[model samples]
Target chain A: MIQISRLPYYGRQMLNWGVTIASVIVCALILPSRLPGMELLGIGPNWLLIWVVAWSVKRSVLQGAIAGLALGLIQDGMTSLHPSHTLSLMCVGILTASLKKQRYVQEDFISVALIVFGMTVVAETVLALQFSLVGDRSLAEIWTDHQQIALSSAILSSLWAPILYYPLNLWWEKMNWIENNA
Target chain B: MDTLRRWWDRNWLQVALIGLVISTAWVARQTQGGSLFEVYQLLTRPFQSNPSKQELLTNAKVVEMEAKLQQVEKENQKLRELLGYVAKNQQQAIAAPIVGRGADHWWQQITLGRGSNDGIKEDFVVTAPGGLVGRVSSVTAHTSRVMLISDPSSRVGVMINRSRFMGVMRGKSGNKAVMQFFERVPDVRRGDVVTTSSASELFPSGLPVGRVESVNLSQSPAPEAVIALSAPTSVLEWVAVYPVEKNTDSETSQANSK
Candidate 1:
């Protein structure tokens, strides 16, 4: 990768950081939109959750947790503060990180999509549990609402996960290669 | 000592990076992600729908009729006031576009294009052309989030416009809501208009909420009425925000007791 080294040192670092942060910004912006074919049953894909899963799949447990926490906070700010989103997202991050894909599953889009699908349900269940404990909503309503949200969100998120995961994984792999060679 | 130093040097950068990420996220949460919303508004500006020709035409007619209605209603109110009527204060309306829906399905909320910058504040009343929509729960500089009346957690004191029977309305997770009346033999029927009562501290009195679609007087604890919201909340495009008047009497009483 002579071309990679030919770039000015600080410029390359800045470019990498810029691209990473830009992707995060793009995901955040898409959070509230309900674009055509992007929605199912009035619910759009959980873009941030998908991003978190994609980011954590190849990273450490702590790295995954950090992404989850940050994204969850951003989501809370976007929506309501009470019944925080941090716990559910953090759980998603931790579970995805610990999936140990290298052992049982291959590094493929299918695996990523499957992981995201399962994580989506887990994340939503955690949120419903919080709502139930907090007593903001009746148990009957929360669980009923949970089934609808969890199914739609999971399906939408899994179908959309590969779109984000493919490119980001490529970039990170290249970065890792460069780091090791350097 | 050499091994320890090597370990420290190897991991310090990673540790610092993770810490920075986590702390920044925590701060963003504390501030409710104002910067994120601002960026979201900027990026989505191109996709936002503009006022159509039909909207302009309809608005012109609505404005004319509203002016006439206001004049007549004002005169009627004056007459009623002279006869000892307790007139409720009128809301100051601000028209705003619905920019986005809830970030997650767990919460029933909508993001409006107008915010604190446009004089919108928490607890301001939000209504559409058909009826009461919801209230402003939080605001950023250029965007505000509304908690719709269909949210399961929201509770509002309401009454039958025709029968004057008191009830409490609760969201049932969709366009419909359930109202539980305090009276066992409440005089409520299908198609009766539901409005917020004077007793509701959260909402102003007499704002149209919805219409009763069905009534069950024999329900266990209390009678219940199912209301079908007149406003098409599922596909709301625009809403009118209104300033809520503070209760001066309550403030005076607190001051006197102090």
Candidate 2:
């Protein structure tokens, strides 16, 4: 909220990177919590996935992929190795970035929420495919699980997407404006 | 050559910066996000309350159950002693506060506040008041990540306590687990108790897991029953992590026995 444009170019750039890193950290720390209303059934909202989607909505393809890779690996650290999260997240990143939201979407919150809901289903599908390919569990079992997780995760993530998307969207817009006007 | 040099000069910092970010993320992944949990432990320190103060909340039913279990255990110990069966040492447990939930939904996991600094290690079995919760999968300096028994990938050798019908228990998301009996028509019924068998490599023998909620004997390949986890995996606030002392021979045999 402070006057970013008043600062020197190097300082502004440093502050921008700081904000980005801090946001990622916030998302990571909240990944394991089941706070009051943040959970549905036994599942909490996918914070990192939400962050990646918010990041890639306005970025280039390359940038989105990179963000996805980093967040995915961190998520892998938190979970297990097989059926890696990298593929699902990377796919989400590229898809969201390629949408190039500024031109297509009209309403901010609703569109972001819609994108988040769809992306959650896609991400879960990618995970299910990985599990199936690994040949660990029966195909029937995997799909049945896929249906429940995808629906619940999609509903929860989209409902909570605005909480993360709004603040991050505001910050990015402010920084970009400062870069143009300063 | 001059153009190449100019490009490198313009982009060297960006390349190096991105490389740094990426390499750091990779290291964090390799270490199981050690640094992140350390920070989480620090941030949540103020919110954790004393566990002993909850004695007042222990209802009469639980107290009565505890007394009955203690009596049974005492009789079992005396019988084992008379039979000359060598008993394994009961290792002490380290109580840790649950700081986080699974990073992602696909895998059911929890993060504990105690880690290596407190002598916690990977593969330590965690338990809540009702029964077995899960086992530690990764450990950092001040935090450890536990793979809950409710994860689909988690399969533990279990037996129906009433009938001793051996089978494998598979975790479903949430607190439900599906147990497949080894015999075609096992003597399992609704509301039967399930416990970890002597064959589970990742957990100790005879740990209370959950109760049978429903039974499906007609499933192809094997009979399956749904178990309602008693540890409250969906609402766990704290757990006790016990160190595993049995060495390679015992662990390998149990692993292969499955």
- In candidate 1, position B257 carries an lDDT of 100
Sequence-dependent TM-score of model 1: 0.90
Docking class of 2: medium
Q: Residue B90's C-alpha lDDT in candidate 1?
A: 65
How big is the positional error of residue B178 in model 2, measured in Å on the Cα after superposition?
A: 1.7
lDDT of 2 at B152: 84
Residue-wise C-alpha lDDT for candidate 1, range B1-258, written one tens digit per residue: 999899988877656766776677777677767777777777777867765732864667788998998999889999989998677666668888888888888878888888899999999989998788998988899988899998887899899999899999998877889999998899988899999886777887778899999988888899999999888887768889999865544445768999
C-alpha RMSD in Å of predicted model 2 compared with the true structure = 3.1
Evaluate residue A33 in candidate 2 and report its C-alpha lDDT on the 0 to 100 scale: 73
Q: TM-score, chain B only, every model?
A: 0.86, 0.91
Instruction: Give DockQ: model 1.
Output: 0.74
What DockQ does every candidate get?
0.74, 0.73
